[model samples]
Target: MSRIAKRFAETRASGRAALIPYVTAGDPAPDVTVPLLHDLVAAGADLLELGVPFSDPMADGPVIQLACERSLAHGTRLRDVLAMVREFRQTDSETPVVLMGYLNPVERMGAEVFASAAAEAGVDGVLMVDLPPEESDDLTGLLERAGIDPIFLVAPTTADARLSHVAAAARGFIYYVSLKGVTGAQSLDPAALGARLGAIRAITELPLGVGFGIRDAATAGAVARVADAVVVGSAIVRLAEQYPDAPERFRAAAAELAREMRTAMDAARADAAPAAV
Candidate 1:
C-alpha cells in the first residue's frame, strides 16, 4: 500500500481521523516549501498534500485561487514541485506526500510518463481535482502500476452512481468534499457531511477524508468525529499568503493551527471511547 493508504489504515485502526494539511508547493518560495512541510508533519499532520499551482484552479475559492496566482507568479511548475519533493525525499520518505493539482500539467506530461516521474520523485499519491473518473481510468491504472494511489473526490451533492464510481476508482482514500461550494468557503456541517458520507461508506471500505472549508480546531474537531481524515486546505495556503515575505512566521502560525486541531480531535476521540467496566 502507498504511505497515504497505510497512514489512513493505521489511523482508522486506532479509531482516529488523520490530519491532512494542504500547502501550495511554491507559494512563498521553493526554498521554504520543504522546511514548512517538515514543520507541518511535526505539528501533527499525518499527511501533506502539496498543490501544484495552475493558471486556473476552478474548484478553489478566492483564498486558494489567490495562492495559485502567487505561486505561479513565483514561477512554480509541476517540474519544480516534483524537484522539491525529490529533494524532500532525501531526508524523509515515510511522511506521505500527495501532490494535488489539476489535470492540465499531468496531461501535458502524458499519463504513464507523469506517473513514472512522480514515482521517481517520491510522490505517494495524487488528487487531481479536475480529472473525471470516466476519463481517469488510464491514468489511475498507470499510477497503480507505479505503486502510487489515485485519490478521487466525492462531494456532498454527488449522486449515488457517481459516488459508487468514485469508490470504485479511488485507491488511497476518498476525498469527501464536505460542502457544496468551492474550496475555502465556510459553510461546513459535520452532521450533514456524516449523512452524505454514510452512503459513500457503503459503496467502499476505503477511508473517507472530508475537506473544503475546514479552517480551525473547532471545525476540524467537529469533522474528525465522523470522517476518517479531516483535510485542511485553504487555511494552510492562506498562511503562506498571510506572510508572503516571512515563510518562517507563516509556518509557525500554521504549526500552531495544526497542533490545536490535532489536540482537539484527539481529546474528542478520547472522550468518545467507551468507559471500561
Candidate 2:
C-alpha cells in the first residue's frame, strides 16, 4: 500500500482518527524544516503536510500568507522544499509527507519533472489549492505515474456532482474544508460538520480528512468523531510565527499542541467505542 493509505489504515485499526499537522517549508529558517518535520512525527502526527511557499497563496489566510513570505524571503524554492523532504526521509520513512502548494511552481518545473522530483524526495502526495480536478489531468496523471497521490480539497459549498468528480480524481484522501472561508477562519460547527460528512460519506468511501478550522484539542476531538483525519494548520503555523527567532521553541510549542490534540482524539475515539459483547 502507499504510505498514506497504510498510515490511514493503521490509524483506523487503532480506532483513532489520524492527526495531520501542516507547516510551511523553510518558515523561520530553511535549515530548521527537516528537524521540525521530525518533531511533528515524534509528537504523534500521522501525516505531514509541508507547504511549498508561493508568491500568491490566495486560499491561505494572513498567517499562512506571511509564512510563505518568510520562506520566500529566505530564497526557499520548490527544490529546497523537496530537499527538506528528502533529508527528513533519512531517519524516518514511515510517516507520509504531502506537499501542499499552488500550481505555479509545479507548472514552472513541468508536471512530469516535478512529479519525479517529489517522488524521489519521499513525498507521498501533493495538494495544490488552486488546481481544480477538471484542469488537473496533466499533474495528476504524472503524479499517479510516479506513485504520488494527488490530494484534492472539497469545500462546504461543493455540489454533489463536483464531489463525485473530485472523489473520482482524488487519491490518498479528500480534504474537506470545514468552513467556506480561507484557512484560519474560525467558524467550524461540529454538529453541522458531522451532517455534512454524513452526506459526503454517501458518495465515496475514500478516507475523508477535515481541515481549515481545527485549532485545538477540543475542536480536533470533535471533528475526530466524524472524520477519518483532522488536519491542524494555522494553529501550528501561528506557533512558528510566535517564536520565529527561536526554532527550538517553535518545535516545542508545535509538538505540545500536536500531542494534546492526539491525546484528545484518542480519548474521544475510546469514548465512542462500541460496547464489547
Candidate 3:
C-alpha cells in the first residue's frame, strides 16, 4: 500500500483521526525544514504537508503567505524542497510527506520531470491549490505513474457534481477546506462541518481531511470527531514567522502544538467510540 493509504488504514485501526501538520519548506531558513519535519513526526504527526513556496499563494492567508516569502527569500526552489525530502528519508521512511503548493513551480519544471523528481525524493503526495480537477488529467497521470498520489482540495462552496468530479480525479485523501475563506481564517463550525462531511461521505469512500481553520487542540479535537484527518497549518507557520532567528525554539513550539493536537484528537476519538459489547 502507499504510505498515505497505509497511514490512514493504521489510524483507522487505532480508532483515531490522523494528525497532519503543515509547514512551508525553508521557512525561517532552508536548513530548518528537514529537522522540523522530524520533530513534527516525533510529536505524533501521521503525515506531513510541506508547502512548496510559491510567488502567489492566493488560497493562503497572511501567515502562510509570509511563510512562502520567507522560504522564497532563501532561494528555496521546488528542487530544493524535494532535496529536503530526500534528506528526511535517510533516517525516517515510514511517514508520508505531501508537497502542498501552487502549479506554477511544477509547470516551470515540467510536470513529467517534477513527478519523477518528487517520487525520487520520497514524496508520497502533491496538493496543488489551483489545479482544477478538469484540467489535472495529464499531471495526475504523470504523478500516478511515478507512484505519487495526486491530492485535491474540496471547499465548502463545492457543488455535489464537482465533488464527484474531484473524487474521480483525486488520490490519497481529499482535503476539505473547513471554511469558505483562505487558510488561517477563523470561522470553523464543527457541527456544520460534520453535516457537510456526512454529505461528502455519500459521494466517495476516500478519506476526508479537514483544514483551513483548525488552529489549536480544541478545534483539532472537534474536527477529529468527524474528519478522517485534521490538518493544522497557519498556527504552526505563525510560530516559524515569530522565531526567524531561533530555529530550535520554533521547532520545539511547533512540535508541542502538534503533540497537543494529537493528544486531544485521540481523546476525542476515544470518547466518541462505541463501547465494547
Candidate 4:
C-alpha cells in the first residue's frame, strides 16, 4: 500500500484521526525545512504537506502568501523543495510527504520531469491547488506512473456532478476545504461541516481531510470527529511569520501546536466512541 494509504489505515485502526500539518518549504530559511519536517513528525504528525513556494498562490490567504514570499525570497525553487524531501528521507522513510502548491512550477519543470524528480525525492503525493480534476489527466497520469498519488481538493461549493469527476481523478485523500474562502479564513461551523462531509462521504471512499480554518486544538478536535484527517496549515505557518529568523523557535512552537491538535483529536474520537456494553 502507498505510504498515505497505509498511514490512513493505521490511524483508522487506532480509532484516531490522522494529523496532517502544512508548512511552506524554505520558510524562515531554506535550511530550516528539513529539520522542521522531522520536528513536526516527532510532534505527532501522521503526514506532512510541504508547500512549494510560488509567485502567485491565489487560493491562499495572506498568511500563506507571506510564507510563499519568504520562501521565494530565499530563492527557494521546486527543486530545492524536492532536495529537502530527499534529505528528510535519509533518516525517516515511513512518514509520507505531500508537495502542495500551484501548477506554474510543475509546468515550468515539465510535468514528466517534476513527477520523476518528486518520486526520486521520496514524495508520496502532490496537491496542485489550481489543477482541477477535469483538466488534470495528463499530469495525473505522469504522477501515477511515478508512483505518486495525485491529491485533489473539494470545495463546499462543488456540485455533485463535479464531485464525481474529483472522485474519478483523485488518489491519496480528498482535501475538503472547510470554508468557502481562502486558506486561513475563519468561521468554521462543525455542525454544518459534518453535514457537508456526510454528502461527500456518500460519493467517495477516499479518506476525507478537512482544512482552511482549523487554527487550534478545539477546531482540530471538532474537525476530527467528522474527518478521517484534520489538516492544519495557516495556524502553523503563522509561527514562521512570527519568528522569521529563529528556526529553533519556529520548530518548537509549531511542534507544540501540532501536539496539542493531536492530543485533542485523539480525545475527541475517544469521547465519540461507543461505551463498552
Per-residue lDDT for 18-137 in model 3, tens only?
A: 999999999999999999999999999999999999989998999999999998999999999999999999999999999999999999999999999999999999999999888899
Estimate, for each residue in 1-277, the C-alpha lDDT of model 4 and write its tens digit.
Answer: 9999999999988898999999999998999999999999999999999999998899999999999999999999999999999999999999999999999999999999999999999999999999998789999999999999999999999999999889889999999999999999997999999999999989999999999999999999989999999999999999999998788999999999999999999999999887511
Candidate 2 deviant stretches above 4 angstroms? 275-277
What's the lDDT for all of these models? Answer: 0.87, 0.94, 0.95, 0.95
TM-score of each: 0.96, 0.98, 0.98, 0.98
Candidate 3: residue 258 Cα off by (Å): 0.3
Residue 275, model 4: lDDT of 50
Q: What is the lDDT, from 0 to 100, of the residue 87 in candidate 1?
A: 89
Q: After superposing candidate 1, which stretches have Cα over 4 Å from the reference?
A: 275-277
Candidate 4 CA-lDDT value: 0.95
lDDT (Cα, tens digit) per residue for candidate 1, span 87-134: 888988888999999999989988888999999999999999999799
Point out the worst 10-residue segment of candidate 4 by lDDT: 268-277
Residue 105, candidate 2: C-alpha displacement in angstroms:
0.7
Worst 10 residues of 3 by lDDT: 268-277
lDDT of 2 by residue, 126-212 (tens): 999999999998889999999999999999899998999999999999999999899998868999998999999999888999999
